[model samples]
Target: MAEKKFRSGFVAIIGRPNVGKSSIMNKLVGEKVAIVSNKPQTTRTKIMGVVNGEDWQIVFLDTPGLHKPRTKLGEYMMKQASEAREGVDAVLCVVDGQHIGPGDRAVMEDVARMNCPKFLAVNKVDVTTPEGLMPQLQQLATIGFDEIVAVSALRGDNMDKLKDLLSGAMPEGPKYFPDDMITDQPERLICAEIIREKALLNLREEIPHGVGVEMLAITKLSDKLTEIHANVYCERASHKSIIIGKQGAMLQRIGSQARYDIERLLDTKVLLKLWVKVREDWRNRTGDLRAQGYED
Candidate 1:
């Protein structure tokens, strides 16, 4: 059998908060490697989602949203985003089709310094009209990108073209990940993120950004059932009360919702037990942040 030449490399997706960076990455890799939430800072670490074609592979890097650091956790997130650009084959500066502000400018400036081939991925075109999307296209030209791809990660619009563009940038190399691998993240991390995603979806806007989920233990008790114990951490005691909700209704809801997703991911019945804990100033403490899987 004649072996075919392969192309594979890392491509970092850079953007400000709520610009669909995680959504775009999940769409490209065809899996939910990174959690999605309406609130900012949903992705705290660098998640690499692998996309394998017959002839090429694209390792997509989903990074934390570029922002000014307010605590140790925030500093770690910002550092992860910066470090993700260091040795990637290409960079995708994903942006919203409509609002481009100081935050977007800051990300663009940082990505420009990466010294790698950069592509402007204008996302959310489905929500905006041609007139609205036109300005985003025209405005991005001044930033100097190797290519501009308009895509709606939510609807999968023009995603194939975007994938082709990224694959075209891949250099001749061996597959960095196995063909069946969609992400490099551990199953435990995915479970934790799923719990956090449910919390973010059900909790209030004020609580979503401060919440983090830690997978205490996950074990298969039987071939058909898996047991998982996790703790949801917050910054204050009052926040913990809010998470637990009145009469523990909120916590039950979070557990119920998270279990469904976890079961789907594991393809087995799940016994998900959730506990709300108050890790006072956890985001600022190195020990607490590391426990939540946010460290390097």
Candidate 2:
């Protein structure tokens, strides 16, 4: 009997802010490759998540949520999001199933111009009833998506089916990533993102987008323990105070939450040290943006 041929390709996951694109990518990869938060525009760069199947490998690019740019950092993020679809084998355009608004249409319109196979994914089905989703589904059906699947990425609903659909879309090619490899992101970058995600979860709504976490150092203190130092930058002194809290309570909470996930990620105990700093208007300054690792 002949053996099955290997297949591999890239899939760009694009959607507007807070549409669960990162959640879906994390679910599909079966690991947290991208940082996720409820706040809009949480992702500031293009993160790569790899899924290895029996005979196929799918490389997924989890990009920043597409939105109008207001600052230099925002412009960089938008560029990263838009360029992700170029030369990809497929494009998975995600949207919120509960709310199909003009933002959804704008993203789909851009996807419509792509040359690759376009797949539409309606997420958040777990929160929406069949009746509630019907109108949205009907409206989406009119679009020219090669395939459409409604899923709840958080609950793992229909994820396996979605994986199969994505795997089937790949072309016969070499295995792009090794079986054990799940992402292209460096450990330092992932750790920084992890810290940033924790901060986003703990901070107030207005504070997340302006927050940036930079990994200063990761030193192996022993075989069982590692030490990590990070700086959390905000746009104002008041935001810095809020992040640190009175008597350092808020900073402690952020570090405590981040260390748990970091330990799981690195497979060793971590001593995470966090410091709050104010880089006023860093988002609008190109040099500061690059210093914060926002370069394309």
Candidate 3:
């Protein structure tokens, strides 16, 4: 425990794209509330995961990674990342020890003006050499952080120590969630993210960025099963063709993989149906972005 009294507060997890920010939060919270991929900008919004210790509760807000804005969607993502730091108890800055550069610095610049204490976490330590890790630590030291820890979000290295650091940094406050509650995200939103995660993992580089999933319908058939209908939107017809694949093999693979994950998340059998639609530059269109739940 941070103190004898109970401690609870919001902690914003911010970092450059694909630096294991989501991975860290998911590992701490002990569930996959956030979708993770090797691709940059896989996380498009702020997702909250609650961690409950014996005497403390930490609500971790996993925000989209910092990236250069290329469209309204990108703009919304960066805006969400910055907005997450506001009125929070602490800001956790995650950086890849093996790869630290302008993107990581740009992320720091976004949160530099925040009044809350900042904790720098160097992730991917299991693969980082002492020589490779020291420079990142030294460079980050120049940025003025309240505390720093080296961790591996992938292998659960030093997570206990990191959790203790975060707990100690929070002020004594009331619990924000029950001990059993892990996340507050809507089921439909999580469904969309699971589908998007599968696409991100299966599709080519160019296709994943243009793809967005929408939950059309979801209903419980029985106490043990759920049926979900969703649409995968793309910017062009060619992209739709690529997503559907020849003889619909690619689409089937995506659906099978996503269904397995959704079933686990919902704790019930999932019957997921997917359709592809061409939205013609939906990433740049404000209405399309709003309709798809990427509100700005």
lDDT for each candidate structure: 0.88, 0.89, 0.89
Ranking by TM-score: 2, 1, 3
| After superposition, candidate 3 runs with Cα above 4 Å error | 1-4, 109-113
Error of 1 at 185 (Å): 1.0
CA lDDT of 208 in candidate 2? Answer: 91
lDDT of 1 by residue, 138-161 (tens): 877878788888889999998889
lDDT of 3 by residue, 115-194 (tens): 88788889999999878788678877777787778999999998888789898888999998888788878889999999
lDDT of 3 at 1: 56
Supply candidate 2's per-residue lDDT for 279: 92
Distance from true position, residue 276, model 3, in Å?
0.6
Assess the local accuracy of residue 42 in candidate 3 as a C-alpha lDDT between 0 and 100.
95
Which candidate would rank higher by TM-score, 1 or 3? 1
Better of 1 and 2 by TM-score: 2
